[model samples]
Target chain A: MENLKKELKEKIIEALNLEDLTPEDIKDDELLFGEGLELDSIDALELIIILDKDYGIKLDDPKKGKKIFESIETMANYINENRSK
Target chain B: MKSEITHYCQIKNGKVIFDENLLYEDKEVDFQKFIKNAYQFFELDYRKFYKMDPLCKLAVMNSSVLIANLTEKLDPKTALLLTNKSACVDIDLKHQKSITEGFARPADFVYTLPNISLGEISIKNKLRSENSFFIFETFNPEFLITYTQQLIQTKKANAVLAGWVEIAENDYNALLFLVEKKKGIALKKENLLNLI
Candidate 1:
């Protein structure tokens, strides 16, 4: 779980280009959207692509992303359970 | 038709010049690093800036400098007329490579058209009057002058953001002017040529 969270944080930073941030800067429970990281819809799309390309977790419906991408913890937990790659 | 050059921004050779004054310059940096430094210097927090290809990033950076100090809100009647030689060829080549490798990314695919930079500017500034992007073999000041004149004379726009934004290979330059019916030098082809 700890390793998955760290990798997820790194992936988010690289894929969404949180250029000024590092993995340590992102708290596991911090919100990914709105006030926390201030990510927008486009960042969400990039995260979806990251999940598919890096983890082989395909999300056909974007709405599911709201829950899975709520925070680094959520994304790491979801990917650990479902990642094909 | 009478119009004035209210404001302008020129980015070239790792330097950003606004209204003829040198704002930032760093010749040693790579293209991406230079752009990132300029964006940081401007203190711009627009997150979507990262997603833009080099051409769009250049356009947005230039326009952001041009409109930074306006006391009044931008007129919705503002039109954008931008010209470029390469016309998103840089991003197009990247997208083509992605397709050949069987891993085409949609984000890259969206910027295949050069005018998408105009869309980015309009969305950021909320200017909805008129906008067009043209491709020229070389910088053509006469056409820009003529088109800007027509837009002002026809009362189609109260202001026109017109300029040349060229990105070829690793080299890039953006020269943009805000044309309006206000106090400034007359918008002339010679003046535009001299600035570029």
Candidate 2:
């Protein structure tokens, strides 16, 4: 799970082109949207692409994304449980 | 009161010059690297810059500095009047391919239109005034001056950032100048032409 969280942070940074940020800069529990990373709607779509392409997790319901993408920890845990790849 | 070009910056041949003074240059002249170098040189805080496509990056690369140098505290309604030859064709090609292959990337799709470059400028400057982008076979200084004069005269804009940004075939030429009611270089066609 520790390794998975670190990988998630790197993937998020790469997928969103958060050029100035590194995995060390992002805390596992820090918010990914609104106040923390301040990611917007377009970034959300890019995150969706990351989930599909990397984790093989198809987010059919957009509403579920609100909870699943809350933080790096949540994303890593979700991938642990559901990722096909 | 008449429109005057206060501050101007040019990006061409891998060199960035403001008011005839060299500010930055890249011998490689790669579009991505040039923009990245400019952003780093300016020490920009805008994170949205990373998401923008090359056209918007080109627009912002010139604008970030000029807008920061505006010290007079002009109206928030500063307008943008821009002319471009390529008109986002660079991103449009990639977006079209993305659509054909599978899904259209939202970020790329959003920048397929040239005017979005104006949006990037607006976001950086917090401008609420009118903005326009025109496509021409060449840089149309005449059209830019005419419209800028009209906008300022009609109260549509307090000031205008008028310039040309042409990006095609991996080459780019951009010039942006802030125009106010008075001072600095006279906003004349010949003056604008001479600067180019």
Over the stretch B123-192, how does candidate 1's per-residue lDDT look in tens digits?
A: 9998887899999999999999999989989888989999999997668889999898898877887888
The CAPRI quality class of candidate 1 comes to: acceptable
TM-score of each: 0.92, 0.93
Error of 1 at B34 (Å): 0.2
lDDT for B1 (candidate 2): 69
Candidate 1 collision pairs? none
Q: Please report how far candidate 1 places residue B143 from its true position, in Å.
A: 1.2
Relative to the unseen true structure, what is the C-alpha lDDT of residue A20 in candidate 2, on a scale of 0 to 100?
A: 86
lDDT of 2 by residue, B59-123 (tens): 98888777666677757878888898889988899889978977677778888899999988887
lDDT per model, in order?
0.88, 0.86
Return the interface RMSD of the candidates, in order shown, one decimal each: 2.3, 1.4
Off by over 4 Å in 1: A61-63, B70-73
TM-score of chain B of each: 0.96, 0.94
